[model samples]
Target chain A: MIPKLNIVPFVSVDNMMKLVLSIGVERFLTELAEVVEEDFRRWESFDKTPRLAAHSPEGVIELMPTSDGTAYGFKYVNGHPKNSRTGRQTVAAFGVLADVGNGYPVLLTEMTILTALRTAATSAVAAKHLAPRGARTMAIIGNGAQAEFQALAFKSLLGIDKLRLYDIDASASQKCRRNLAGFGLDVTICGSVEEAVQGAEIVTTVTADKQYATILTDNLVGSGIHINAVGGDCPGKTELHADILRRADIFVEYPPQTRIEGEIQQLAPDHPVTELWQVITGQIPGRRDPRQITLFDSVGFATEDFSALRYVHSKVTGTAFFEELDMVADPDEPRDLFGMLLRAAA
Target chain B: MIPKLNIVPFVSVDNMMKLVLSIGVERFLTELAEVVEEDFRRWESFDKTPRLAAHSPEGVIELMPTSDGTAYGFKYVNGHPKNSRTGRQTVAAFGVLADVGNGYPVLLTEMTILTALRTAATSAVAAKHLAPRGARTMAIIGNGAQAEFQALAFKSLLGIDKLRLYDIDASASQKCRRNLAGFGLDVTICGSVEEAVQGAEIVTTVTADKQYATILTDNLVGSGIHINAVGGDCPGKTELHADILRRADIFVEYPPQTRIEGEIQQLAPDHPVTELWQVITGQIPGRRDPRQITLFDSVGFATEDFSALRYVHSKVTGTAFFEELDMVADPDEPRDLFGMLLRAAA
Candidate 1:
C-alpha cells in the first residue's frame, strides 16, 4: 500500500521478531548501545519527568514520556509479577514515536522485545564506563526473561565471554544456559548465588519480586566489581540490601526518578549520587579506583526508550518489518472534517 | 483469522467514520451523552490527574490518563492552531483502553473523530442539566471542525432546531451551514458573534485560536442563556471577557485543570466554581433561576475521554469496524522470551 500522511508504520510482535532476527540480535544491541550513548551525551536537551504510574493490588501500569523538541516518544508498559503464573509475560509494552511539529505519530511498535534489548544495551553501556578493565566473567542472578539479552549484550559490547547464571528456579538457569549454547559464551549454571558470584568481575541482579527482598547482600559483593541492579524499579520493589547500597558508589539515570524507584531508595533522601550522563560526557569519573565498587541503578528512563524507538524507525525505513496503519484523521480541508465524513457516506 | 491472546482491536479513522455513520450521528450522540452522564454520576471512583503536557514554541502535546479501578484509558492529543493553514487538523487525537487487572491494552483507536463526538456529547449532557427548560434555539461561534457535531448533539438531546452560526472566517460558517443542511436543522450564517447569539437560549464559543480572544464579550452574553465555552482549553488561551465571567456562575469539569486552562484563568485564584459532576449527581442545583447566567468552562477532562473510549469499546464488539492488531508479545513460556526469539530463527 502507498504511504499516506495519516498512516503510521506499525511494528507488530511478529514483524519485530523478524526485524531482530534479520539484523542479528548482537549486532542490533551493539548498534543500539552506540545510539544510547549518543543520546546520553546530549541528555540536557531532553524534557524529562518521572514516569506516571498507577499502582494496583495486582500490578502497576506506567506511561514514560519524553521529548527532545523535535520528536516526542512514550512507552506504555506494565509489570505484573503474578502474570507469569497465569501463562502471561510478567512485563509487556508498546511505544509510539511522533513528530512534535504536527503532533502526528510517525511510528508505533511493540516494545516488549525492544525494551528487553534497550535495558541490556543500557547496562552494557554503563558497564563500559564503570566495569573494571578487561572484565571477562559476568554473573547474572534471577535468570528469567531478561537474562539471555543481558548476557548477549555484554558479550557483544564488552567482550565478556564467560557467563555464570543462577536463579532460585533451576529450570530458569538451565533455560538461560541452553539459549546461550551456540553464542560462543562459556556458560555455567550455578547452584547458589555464592557460587554464581565466585570469581566474576561483574554481577547483575535482576529478580522479579515486587517486595523488599535482598537478592544481593553486602557479604556477597566484593570490591573492584561492578553491579548492575535492574529489577528494583518501583516504589516498594527493591532487590539489594541497604548495606550494599550504602557501601557502593551508586550511579543512576535521572536522580529525581531513581531516588524513588532505584536502589538508592534504600539510602537517605539526601545521599550523594552521580548521574550516569555526567560520566558519559566525561564530566565525572566513572570508576575512581580498581578497589571501588560501582553500582548502576537501572530503573530504565524515557530517553533510553526514545533512542531505541529512533533506532528502530531508521532501520525499518526500507524494510518490510512494519505495516502501515491508518491512524490519524486527514481531512482535505481542515475545517471541513464534517464534510469529509459526509463525503465518506456518499 | 482467530484473535490471538496478544491481539488488540484497532479502530482506524476510516473505520471510526464508518462506525459513526453506521450508528447515525444523532443517535450515537444521544447514547454517548447517556454514557457520559452515567460516568459523571460516579466521579469519585476514578483516579484522575491533570494531563501531562510537553509545550514547545509550535504548540503542545499531551497525555491525558485516567482509571476507574477496573479499566484504564488515556488519550494522546495535540493542539496546533496553525496546523489548519498547512492542511492539518488543528486538534488530532487517539486513545487506548486497557484492562486494569493485567495492564494489557484491549483496544487502540483513532480518536480524532471520537473526540469530536465525545466533546459534543459531553456538552449536550452538561447543558441538559444547566440549560433553561424548553430551550430551542442555539448559537455556535467559531464554526470549525467541531461545530457540526455540537449542533447535531443539541438537536438530538435538547430539542434544539434553530442554529445561528458565526466565524471570523465567513467560509467556515458557510461550510458549517452546508454540513448541517440535511440534518433537519434550520441553520443560518450570521455576520458577527453578536448577531449569532441574538435570541438564542444557548451559546457555544468553540473558537480555535491559541491566544486569549474574547469571542463573547460581557454585553454579548444575556441572562437566562447557558454559555458552553469550548475553545479556551489551555493556559493563555481563553474565549470570554473577564467582565462576562465575573457576572456568571461558572461550572467546570475539573476545577484544578479548568482553573489553569479555562476562561476562569482570567478570574481570581480563589474564585468559587461548582463542579459539573456535583450538578449532574444533583448535589448542587444547575441553574438556580431563569435569569442566572450559567457558564460551563469546559477544558475537557480525562474522564470524558475515558467514558468515550468505554462507549466505543462497547459499540465495536464483534463489528467489522475494527481490525485485530498484533501489538503485544505473548511467549508460550513467559520466562523463555529469548528462546522464543531463537525458535523464530528456525
Candidate 2:
C-alpha cells in the first residue's frame, strides 16, 4: 500500500507504555531530561505563550502551545480533582507536534504518561543546577500518581539512591513504595510530612488538590536543600505555605504564568524569581551557597511539552511503537476535495 | 473485553468521508446547517475566545476553542496558500470534542472535509436569513476546493437551481462544473468575474490568494444581492473592494474576530456590523428591505466547528465510521501510572 500524505503517526496509550518499557523508564527520563536541558539552554529561541485555560466548576481544560521556529507543538490537558472519585485520572493529556512549514501534524501521542515523565525530568534538570551537590536522599510529599516517576527521575538523573515518601492517604504512599521496589532505590514510607522531610537533601512536594492546602510549612523545611513544588500548578491550588515561598530562592518557567498559577501566587506580584533558562545558560547564579534554600516553582510550561513531544517524534521515527492515523484530508487534486469525495462514493 | 475510559473515538479521513457519503452530502449539509443555526441561537451561552494563531512566513497554525458549558471543542487548522504548489491542501484541519465534566476527550476527528461542509452550510444558513426571497441563481467567483460544496449547499438549503462559476484557472471552474453536473443544478462556466455575476441573485467570492486582491468590486455588486465572502479570512487577505463593503449592510459571526480577519478589517475600527446571532435570535433584522445589499463576512468561527464536531459525534454513536483510540493513559489504579507501565512490560 502506498503511504498517504494525510497519515499522521499516533502513539496510543498502549503503544506509549510499550515504548517506555522498551526504552526503560529510567533511560527514557534521562534522555528526555537531556533534551529538556538543551531546550532550556537556548530557551530564547522558543515562541512562548501562557496556556489558554477554560475553567469550569469541576475542572479546567487547557491548551498549552509553543513553537521553536521549525516545529509547533501543543498539549491538551485537563485537571479535574474530583475525577478520581469516578476511577478517572485527575489529570489527563494528549499532544500534537506539527511541521511549522507545511502546518501538518507529524505526531499525535498520549501525553498523560508523557506529562508525568517530562515533569519529573524537568524537576531533575532544575535540581541538578539548584540542589546541593552529592544529594542522595529525596523526601517526596504527596505520594500520588506522579510520585514514583519523580523518585525514578531523581534516581536516574541525580543518582539519588534513597526516597522518603509521605501522603495523607497511607495507601497512596504504599502503592508508590511498591512500584519503586525493583528500581534499586531504598524506599521508606513515613507516617507524617515532618518525618518524610527529616534529614533529606531534596524535598519534592507533589500533592494533588485544588485548594490552598499547605503540604509543606516553613517550619518543616530546612536550608541547603532543593524543593520541587510540583502539585501547586493552578490558581487557588498550592502545596507550600506562603512562608516557605518567602524563605526560598524561587525559580520558575515562564514568570508570567508562574506568577498566576505557581506557589508564587501567594507572594507579592513583584517578588523576584529567576527564570530556569538563565540558570541553565549560566547567565545567573544557581544555589548561591550551600545553605541557600532553592525552590523550583514548577507549574509546567509549553516548551517542556514541546521538547518532550519533539523527543518522542524522534524516537518513533522508524519504530513499531506508532500507528499511522489518517487525520488530514488529502485529495489527489489539492483543490478537488469535492471531487475526491465524489470519487470515494463511486 | 472491558471498555477503557482512555479510549477516545476517532473519525479518520476515510471514516469521515464514508460517514459523510453514507449520510449523503446534501442531507449532511442541510442537517449541519440546522445545527449551526441552533448554535447561533444560543451563541451567548458559549465561552468564546479569538483563535490562538502562530503565524509563520510560510503559513499559519491556529487553535480555535470553545465550550457550551457541558462539552468543550477545539479545531486545529492551518492555512498555507503555497502548499498547493507541493500537491497539498491549502487548508487542512482536525478537531476534538471533549467532556467538560471530567475533561477527558470523547471524540477526535478529521475536519478538512467537515470544514468545507460547515463553511458552505453556514454560508447557506446566513443566506437563508439575508438573501432575497426566491433567489435561485448564485455566481461563485474562484471555483476551487470550496466551490462545489457552496453550490450544493445553496441548492440543498435555499433551493438554488442556477450556478455561474468563474476562476482565474479556468480548469478549476471546469472541474467544479464537471463535479456538480448531476446535482440537478444549472451550471455555467463564466470566462470572467463580471460575466459570472450577471443576472445572479447571490454572489460568492471564494478566492484563495493570501494578499489583498479585489475579486469583487463595488460596480459589480447590484442591489438586492447577498454577498457571501468566504476566502479572505485572514488579516491582509480580503476579496471585496472597500466601496462594496461600504454599500453592503455587513453581518459577521464575531465582531472582535471579524474586525481583524474578515472583510470589515478595511472598515473603521467601530464599523456598525450586526452580529449574525442577533439576527438568528430575532433581536435585529437580517435583510431590512428587498433592495438592500447584504454581505455576510464569512470568516468561520470556532462555534461552527464546535457544532459540526458535536453533530458528527452524535452520528458516530454505534456506527462503524469511527475507531477507538487509546489516547489517554488510564492506569488500573489511578494513582499507579508507573505500575501500569510496569504491568505493560510484563
- Best candidate per lDDT, number? 2
Residue B283 C-alpha lDDT in model 2: 98
The DockQ of each candidate is: 0.84, 0.88
Report the error of model 2 at residue B192, Å: 0.8
* Regions of model 2 farther than 4 Å from truth: A1-3, B1-3
- Candidate 1: the clashing residue pairs are none
True contacts kept of each: 0.82, 0.85
Question: If you assessed candidate 2 against the hidden native complex, which CAPRI class would it receive?
Answer: high
Cα lDDT over the full model 1: 0.93
Residue-wise lDDT of candidate 2 within A1-346, one digit each (tens)? Answer: 1267899999999999988988989999999999999999989999889999999999999999999889999999999999889889999999999999999999999999999999999999999999999999999999889999999999998999999999999999999988888889999999999999998999999988999989998899888989999999999999998998888999999999999999999999999999999999999999989999999999999999999999999988878999889999889899999999999998
